[model samples]
Target: MDLWVAGVDGCKAGWIAVFRNLKDPAATRLHVFAEFPDLLKFDPPAQVIAVDMPIGLPERVGAGGRAPEKSVRPLLGQRQSSVFSVPSRAAVYTEDYRDACEISLKTSEPPRKISKQAFYLFPKIREIDAVMHPDMESRVFEVHPELAFWRLNGEAEMSLPKKIKGRANAPGLNQRRDLLVSYGFDQAFLDQKPPRGAGRDDLLDAAANSLIAGRIQFGEAEPFPKSFTRDVRGLRIAIWA
Candidate 1:
C-alpha cells in the first residue's frame, strides 16, 4: 500500500481527517476518528500528518503565547482572532475550567486568564501532546487551516468568513473549494457533506491542511517561526504552511 498524507481538525464529535496518496491526488479520503490514537491505525499509515491544533505548549507564560501562534497572527491580519492563546501545560492538565484558569494565572509570568474557548480545547491539545514523541516530529506537524488557505490564496487573508449562519452556499465555502480544486482536489469531494458530527467547514479545513501536508512532504512548505522552540518533552511547536 502507498503511504498517504493526512490533515486533521478537531470537531465537536472528534477529529475530521483528509487523507490523500500524493501519487494519486484523485484518491482522496475522509475519515472521522474518536481519538487521536485512532488516526494512527491506517494500514500503511500517513507519512505526513498536519493537524490544526496546538501541540507544543510553554511551561510558563511568555510575552506572547506560543511562538508559532505569534508569528502567524500578524500574517492572518483580520483573521488573527482565530488563533487562541494556548494555556501552559499546567493549565491544560487541570480538570476544571476554573482550575485551568487558576493554573494559567499562576504559571504565566505577567499572569493571564485562560479563555473558555482555550479551556474547551484542552482535551484535544492534551491528546496530541501526550502521544507526540520527538521521533515523530518529522512526520507529524502543526498547521493552521486559515494560514494554509492564506498561502493558497497567494498569501492574502481570505476576505470571507468560513462559517456563515443560515446559508448553505456561502461564498467563502465556494472560495475555499475553488482554491482546493486548483490544487487537484475533486469538486465532488469538496461538495460532499460532512458526517453527523462534523461540519462542512471542518471538512474544508482538513482538506486545506492536507494540501499543506503534501507540500511539506514534497519540501514545498514553510514554517512560520524560522527558528522554533521545543517544549521540555522535545516537541517542536511550530505551524507550517
Candidate 2:
C-alpha cells in the first residue's frame, strides 16, 4: 500500500501527517511535527513525504566565513514550471549544477547576509527534497521532503493569518489554526473531542491536515486539482514534492 508523510511549518513551528493507502481514501496517521521518531513504528512502506517550506536559497553565500559554504537554491523555474537542481552546496558553487541555477542573478551583501549554514538548516531541506523525488515510491527511513496541502488539493492558495479569536495564545497564525480545526472536524472527525487549552485543538488540526496531504501525494487518494486554483484569499501558494 502507498504511504504518505507530510510536514508543515509556519511562522512559529508546524506539524506532520501520514496517510496510508490513499487509493482507499480511508487509511491514515497524523502526528505532530516533533513526533517524527514515531515513524519507526511502520517500518518500510512505499511512501512519499512532503514538506511545507522553502527548499533552497537563491544563491550560494559564505556561512561562518568558512570554505565549506554551499549553494542555497535547489530548484529553478523554467518558463512556468519548477525543476530540481544539484544535490550539494559545493556542487553548485562551481557552477556544476547550472541546470538548477536560478534565472535571476543575485548577490548577498555583508550585514544584510547571514554568516552561518547552521542557521540555514531549514533551507537545506530543498537539497534533501531534490534527492527524494526520484523515489517518490521509495519507503523513507528518515523524514523526507514534501508538502501536504498541494498533495490533497493540488495547487491552491494558503492564507494563514497571524491572529485568531480563541487561539491568540498559540504562536503563528489565525487562518491556519482555523484550517486545522476545519480539517479535524471534517476530515479526521476529531472535532467532537478537540484537545483542551488555547491552541491545542489548532495544533491537532494542523497535524491532521499535514498527514492528509502526505496521503494525497502518496497516491493513496485522488486529488481534485480541477477544483483548485493558484491563489485564494490573497495568499500566495507554493507546491513541491
Candidate 3:
C-alpha cells in the first residue's frame, strides 16, 4: 500500500495543500480545498497532515498567549513575530471583535489583548478547532512554515521575509523554493503561481509543511513543548516541525 502525507496552509481562497506519496516520490500533487474537512476526501488518505494553523486553543489566557507560541517564538529569533498568539477559547467563540477583545482582557491572567492580525485568523482557527478530535492527534498536527524553513536551513532563520513583492525576484521565496527543490519537489511545479486567491508564498508554505508531515510520518519531527496540555476539547497544544 502506498502511504501519503500532506501539508496544508490557509489562503484567501481557502486552504492550499501539497500531497506526497512516500512510496512513489514522483507522485506529488497540489490541491486546493474550500474547507479544512475537505482535505480528508483523498482516495488514499494522508497518513499525516501538518497544517500551518493554531490547533489547540487556551481556555483562559495565561501569562503569555498559547504555550506553543511562547515556546516557538524564542527558537525563531528574528522571525519570532511570525508566531501569532492564539486567542482563548472564549474569545474564539465570540463573533464580534470588540466582544472578543473584552473576553480576552477579562479572562487572561495578564490581560493579553488579541491583535488585529490574530483576530483576522479567528474564523480559520475556530474551523480547525471545531473539526479536530483527540483521536486525530497523531494523524493531524500543527506546524509553522517559518520554523520548518529554519530547520531546513540548518536551524538559521531566513533573513528575508517570505512574502515580499514588487521585486523581479524575491530572495526569501526563492530561498524557500530552492530548499523544497533540494527535497525532491519539482522546481517547475513549485515555481508555478498559485490559483487566484492564493499567493506564491502560500504554495511554498504548504509545500514546506507537506515535507514536515513526511518527516512526522517517518518519526523525524519534534514538537515544540516536550510536555503539552490538552484543551477542554482534548486537542494537544503544541507546534510540531
TM-score per candidate, in order?
0.95, 0.39, 0.95
In angstroms, give how far residue 73 of model 2 lies from its true place.
Answer: 15
TM-score (C-alpha, index-matched) for candidate 2: 0.39
Q: Model 1 over residues 107-226: C-alpha lDDT tens digits?
A: 887899888778888899999988999898898899999999999999999988775443444788888999999999999998897977998889999999999999999999988798
Lowest lDDT 10-mer window, candidate 3?
161-170
lDDT, residue 1, model 3: 80
Cα-based lDDT for every prediction: 0.89, 0.34, 0.87
lDDT of candidate 3 over 1-241, digit per residue (tens): 8999999999988899999999997788889998998887766799999999998888787775778888888888877878877778999888889899999998888887788878888888888888999999989999999999988888888778765343333787898899989989999999897988888989999999998999899999999887988888888998998
Clashing pairs in 3: none
- Backbone clash total for model 2 is 14
**Model 3 lDDT, full chain set:** 0.87
Model 3 bad stretches (over 4 Å): 164-169
